[model samples]
Target: MSNIGSNPLIHFAAGATSATIACVSCQPMDLIKTRLQQSKQTKDAEKYSSVAQAARTIIQEDGITGLWRGSTSNVMRVVPGAGLYFLMLQMANRRYRARTGHAMTPLHALLTGSFARAATAVIANPAAVAKSRMESVGVWEYKNGRSAVIDVLKTSYTRGAMIQVLGDVIYSGISFAMVNTTSPFAQKKASPTSQFIVSAVAGAVGTAAAYPLDVVRTRVALSKAQGKDAGIVAVVREMLEEEGIAPLYRGVEFVALRRAITTAVTWSSYRAITAAVGRARR
Candidate 1:
């Protein structure tokens, strides 16, 4: 409930801290989500069987770094996104309370948070896409089929980063809105032990909702790096033809679990930070 926007430094600091924490805590699940999202079943599905299996496989194959494949992009996207989100939440909460003449409730918090997240997603879509791509498929494919981030970026660049970013912004905004709208209701009805269930559900729903765009973004990013021209429509059609609609929601469970943990951590931390700041100010 602090005026985060009014104090730019504090807002930024809080945002940075929050983003860092959120990314670190959820990176493993994020890796799983990316893998699932990017999974393409050939004649035989040569992919991890489940989320747990995926984690173990990644560890066995690529070491811990594989699990943190997109940590850089995650930091880039999250720091700004989270900063904007927290700042907006404070601003929105204040406005909502002033207009309604009531204190912040869970519903208010949820709506405001969702709106802020959507806004940030719009701005940070390209980065988010880049991060997801970097995490899921790496930057390039070697002759044998594996690539690095830099190589991937160098290959992809047809539409330019700006264009991709714009597309991402739109996709992210819609996705965040969907996730936010349903989260509060899910949480409200959940049992105490299952409070985090809603967060997971929201994450999964959001991932699925945004996944087609995510696939397009990934193809665009990777194709650009590979010097190929694959439009969003073409990519969507290709994915559908090759993998069917189910592929779009492949990594949903991982996304949901990651989201649940991230949300719980974020809210808990934000509350703690706000309280500490309040005590200090007082």
Candidate 2:
């Protein structure tokens, strides 16, 4: 059988499917993270002091469904974002192998993952901004995903996208590098459980390292949505002035948890799907 990663269609399908499953399953965590990050900037600054408090407030105010408020927007962005990222990764790795006759080194994996994530962030930023707006407290007038996108399109969304791209590139690069350096998945004999565990650990490490940028990205998007200054510098300045360094890591625990779960699911599902396709082809 042909190598599964040789086919762009398989890569996209596996990536998109894995993203969808991860997004749907872990959306509540995302929502809570967004809410926590935005809470400090909102009028009700004390509304969500912690994860449990945020979750309780969401359930009480908007029902349990509120925990997934931005899920559609998130899925819209992440599905295609993940697909393109994996496709880019496959193409990059193939080219590297063709030229070097060696598997990607960790450094090469880092560069490839950074490029893929930055490209995806640029393309998917509007949807990401919409997702943040939808998830934040207040500014809940969006009737559907389309309306949210339209609203974001009408605003100054590019700065937030730029900030997001920076964070994502770092996070993706580090996570991919860590996986290549530490994971057992390179061995044909490696079990799926080991792969999953490795991916999760790598993701948690990456998330911890780059998580402050994530908070800034969310705040920038929310600021723009609220017609405030959303420039990266401006958002950082405001955050520092108002809440100091602590606010930048407000929801790190939740995001690290979410990233671990999402990365584990994505990689595991992608491997399973591609393996299944390879088997079927044979």
Candidate 3:
């Protein structure tokens, strides 16, 4: 186990594999969540009134395949991002354990998770911006994932990236603390089922806490894609004044469900892969 933790390749491989699986499984949910967040309700009409409506409209307008509109860009962002995150996490955890002569406490997990996620977000933000735009319900601007990414790279899209990094760092820290706390599962070797359960619980809690930030991030990303520069404060203020508070939680249900599924699958698969690699080396 210690050797596994020390192996950067193992961590990156496990993280990438797990992230690919998790993202593919929840891509449709992600598309819906983006659509819901990007939509606004007026006195007479709404772009997407509900999750079901969003799904139905997407299918009608873009075909059933539309449900996975941004999946390529999402994978481009998350695979390497998740790989780097796990590598950083393992390096941080190993150093912490060495200095303390014990496993990480919740506080340790929180700090390390925040640092790892923040660093990864900086590198992944452009791809993330592309993913959000590709998933948004509007004219399909880019021809492919590469074009979408190139378009984002050509713009000054820093505000949304800052907000996304902040929200993601906090979300990662909370989820890591929740999963690695001094609980029964944390105290002992967690089985795959236990890993899934703990990860699901952590994901749900983190998603709820960070969802408003997510909406803001999505708004800023899409706005930037359209050559608009809106700061976080301005975006939030506009949303509140024009759409009310409910819009901030537009796709909470879909996001919650997707996060739970993604976290559970990612952690369980990561653990299983690392454990297998450890045993193989032994």
Candidate 4:
């Protein structure tokens, strides 16, 4: 059983596969959330007052495919990020149990989850930056995922680049870990029937708490496209000065709703993968 967990390949596979499943299922909501964020920041935000307005506006203005805009970049980041996140989280849980003679507590979840993401943040941040930029409405005119990647990479040489990209990833990790830990099945103790409900609640809570950071992440990703420096502090300062705090929570309602379902799907799939891997070794 321990052997399966030790295999880096298994962790990667589990993370990527589960993330892909979750991303595909909740993509439309993600798209709408992006639109809402962009609208709030822009001068013409009044055109869309609700989630339905955002969706309809995207369909009407950018076509139906616009609703899935930036999905490629989203998958690109989420697959690897989710994979790394789960692998680290699982490893942390194992280590925690070994050290404490019991399962992880909220404190353990908070610390381990933060550490896992911080460790993976360097690799994951660039992808996150790209995903958010691609998702925003009035940002860049990225022709495709490759172009967006190339464009973002062009700015990597700037000072404080790491801090800029990592700020939100760190916040996201802490939020997800803390909320996900609350799952009734987080200790992997729930019966099959109850896993969904428990995991769903956990996912929703974490997603909602972490949403403000997501909004900041998206705006920071767009900084370069808007002809500004791509530092987290600088962008944040500018946002506060120009747009105010309200912009940071622009799409919270839709994001929380969508991610609740996505998180449930992701976490549940992760458990199934872990179970299968463990059973295979047995």
Candidate 5:
């Protein structure tokens, strides 16, 4: 087990694999969540009515595929985020353990995880923004909307991916820190099932913390979809003025659920994979 801790490549592979699996597993819910978030109750109070009702309507109208509308982009965004998040976390944990000559405490785990997640988010933010925009409602309805993905890449290049990347770093850094910090505390006295509950709570906290930035990113990305250029502040202001603060956190509950499921799957799969790898090595 300790030897496995030293193998960076193995850890990276495990993290990437686990993240991919987690993303694929929860993609449908993620799509639904995004749609719900994008819905404007002010524009049409009857649009979705409720998240549960929205889910049912999407499933009925678009079938299973509707629930996974932007799955490809979602997977792309998640793979790197998850992979790097865990890789950084494991590496951080190893260093922390070596320094203290103790197994990772829950607090340590939280800090390491948060740091890793933040780092990954920096690298993966543009793609994440693009994915969120692609998953947004009106963006795809326009005839030129099909080009939104390409436009996102082009706009990102023009604006410098660095800016978007930095935003992601800050957003993920704070969000992960909060979640990771609290998660271990929750898990400390929990049973196995209770640990899952703790993780879910952590995920929800993280999502809520980062959601405002997510809204800004989505709007920025969607602006390109509409053949416009707008920075994060501009987009946020537009949303606030046009839709109110609620629009900034459109699908918060869904985001929470998505994060919770993703966190649970990520940790569970990571543990399983690490164990399997350790067994195989032995």
Candidate 6:
């Protein structure tokens, strides 16, 4: 029960357009989340404390622009990835209905969203790598999005780099799947308010559960870029021993906040956009 338009082209355009706007609003939260994840300090110094503290630090150190670090690379995949995600999930729903002659159940939504997001994540992995690396406070020093991609590609063609890329993609895929599978309830509701609230809540739940993987992915990706590949197991093992599980969940609440805002805005905007386009087509 998705509200995305029947036309694939419209659906794609709606998703891309909506996501771009949402990204701008949500980027600051994302920046703090990334810093929290990439952070390596310990004890009291390790604390970001809250969103306000993290923002002030980033602004004081890197200026306001720092809050949007790596946004170019992020936008690169975000638009198309959003487009592909919605389109594929919708297609999956169609197939499910045709085959079973029933609406998408919660289980169906989970499975379809997971598979669809996994596909989008694989295709968008390079962008993910670039964003995470450039977002890390003092990691790779790519000039911009294009340079970031080229620089990563130089190393990413290697087996080690590819492994790191796959790990990041898988992490993103699962996290997003968990967030989006809750789309059914949101979409089922016709009101924009209900949709926003439900989607936002769904996003928060997913981010809380899957955020640790995001930290691991960022670390592994950066390590690989520096020609020091760290497998997921090693990354998790070392982080656990060195910092414990708490570190893994750092900045998670902020991520949940960002996810809620982004999901609410993106889906509401998407529904509005597609509806407008549909009306114009008449």
Residue 106 lDDT in candidate 1: 48
TM-score of 3: 0.92
lDDT score, candidate 6: 0.70
Whose lDDT is greatest here? 2
**TM of each candidate vs. truth:** 0.70, 0.94, 0.92, 0.82, 0.78, 0.85
- lDDT for each residue of candidate 2 in 1-282, tens digit (9 for 90 to 100): 115748898899888998899998999998888878886666765778889888888999999887888888988898889999888888887888889997788888999889999999998999998888788876557887778888788865575877889899999999988876665444455677788888899899889988998888888777744567657898889888878999877778888989999998988888788888989988
The lDDT of each candidate is 0.58, 0.83, 0.81, 0.68, 0.64, 0.70
Error of 4 at 136 (Å): 2.5
Clashes of each: 7, 0, 0, 1, 2, 0
Candidate 3, 151-176: lDDT as tens digits: 88987446488888988998899987
Off by over 4 Å in 2: 184-189, 224-227
Error of 6 at 37 (Å): 0.8
lDDT, candidate 4, at 6:
70
Model with the higher lDDT, candidate 3 or 6: 3
Better of 5 and 6 by lDDT: 6
Error of 3 at 152 (Å): 0.6
Model 2: pairs clashing at backbone N, Cα or C within 3 Å: none
Error of 6 at 51 (Å): 3.1
lDDT of 5 by residue, 1-282 (tens): 124657877777787887788888887777666666555422433556568787787778778677766667666667777777777766776777679996665555555555565567666665566566666665554223235446556656334244445544544454445545555554566455765665566667767776676656555655654466877667667778887887767777777778888877776677668878999988
- The C-alpha stretches of model 1 lying farther than 4 A from their native spots are 1-8, 41-45, 103-115, 138-216, 224-227
Give per-residue CA lDDT, model 4, range 1-282, as digits (tens).
123657777877888898899897787788777667664455556756678887788888888887778778778777777788778876777777789887677666767766776766666666666767777766567888667767667865333335534553455555555555555443456465466666566556666666666666666556655566656777678778887898777767677678767867876787788788889888
Please give the ranking of all candidate structures by lDDT, highest first, separated by commas: 2, 3, 6, 4, 5, 1
Tens-digit per-residue lDDT, 175-202, candidate 6? 4454455555555665678778876876
